[model samples]
Target: MILFENVSKTYPGSHEALSNVSFHLHRGDMAFLTGHSGAGKSTLLKLIALIERTTRGQILIGGQNLAGVTKRKIPYFRRNIGIIFQDHRLLLDRTVFDNVALPLIIAGLDYREITRKVRAALDKVNLLNKEKQLPATLSTGEQQRVGIARAVVNKPPVLLADEPTGNLDPELSEEIMKMFEQFNQVGVTVLIASHDLELIKRMQHRTLVLGKGKLIAQFPEEDS
Candidate 1:
């Protein structure tokens, strides 16, 4: 489970990125976060990913309070969390297989195990054949799938996506969201921060809205 209790963040100029935000995401739950460009969506995801520390309040992930998690221990904290960035941060110089294998490699998994996991993740995204291809050789949508594969290669229990569909067309966005649904169906907690309201409305998942460093609303899809 993920919990935020009275969390807030402020920049050097006193520009608030998050203000007294508090919420709970249960294990295996799926939710979306939406708002305009300056909304605290990205900041919220950052806090969850441990990429940014909350200026105040507490965060609990998987029963561990983030306040007690030291900076040096951050890497260990990330072992069970997966993050997908808007940019698809693939290594242009590497093959898709290697890129996706990064996390497993960092964990020093056996080569055979890494290969098995990478293949499984790629298969989930239907990009198994593109293993030898460079990220630059693929289209934007395919590259994004590569990113997703990389994020899930470790089989993390929690997944965080920041504007994952920002670079895709509506159709592609639907496809990607469906992929996320597939992951959630298999029991991975998923939280996506995006601005594609019209596109996501059809998917019918819960949505958390943010504005000016504060959570304004939460839309829980009745269909789910």
Candidate 2:
């Protein structure tokens, strides 16, 4: 489970990116974060992933507080949390297989193990046939799938996506959402930041809306 208790962040110039933002996501739950640009959507995810730290309050993932996690321990802490960005962030020079195998390789896994995991991830994204291709060679949607495969290659229990479908058309956007749904079904706690209201409504999952650094509403309302 992920928990945020009265969290807030302020930049060097005292610009508040998030304020007293508190929410809870149970294990295996999938939810959407929606807001306008600079609504703290990205800031919130960054906090959870430790890319940025809260100036106040605390964040806990799976019952462990993130406030005390040191710089040296951040990488290890991140290994179990997968993150996807608006840009696919693939290496244009690398093949899909190589791209997906990067995290495992960095962890010092043997070649055979890397190959097995890479193939399995690619299969999940239905891009096994494109393993040998470069990101530039695939269509926009295919490139995004490659990115998804790379993110999940390590089988992280928590997945966070920021504007994952920002560049895709509506049809492609829905397809991408379905891919997230597939991951959530298999027990990955998923949180996505998106601006597509239509898409969010269509998915019908719990949604947390942020407005100017504060959480303002939740869809379908929480149980009493």
Candidate lDDT scores, in order, read: 0.91, 0.93
- Model 1 regions more than 4 Å off: 221-224
lDDT value for candidate 1?
0.91
lDDT (10s digit) by residue, model 1, range 7-116:
99886686989999988888898999999998889988888888888899989998999888899999988988999989999999999999999999999999999999
Error of 2 at 164 (Å): 0.3
What is the per-residue lDDT of model 2 for residues 45-150, given as tens digits with 9 covering 90 to 100?
9999999999999999999899889999999999889889899999999999999999999888999999999999999889999999989999998999988998
Number of clashing residue pairs, candidate 2? 0
Which portions of model 2 miss their true places by more than 4 Å?
A: none
Q: Which residue pairs clash within candidate 1?
A: none
- The TM-score obtained by model 2 is 0.97
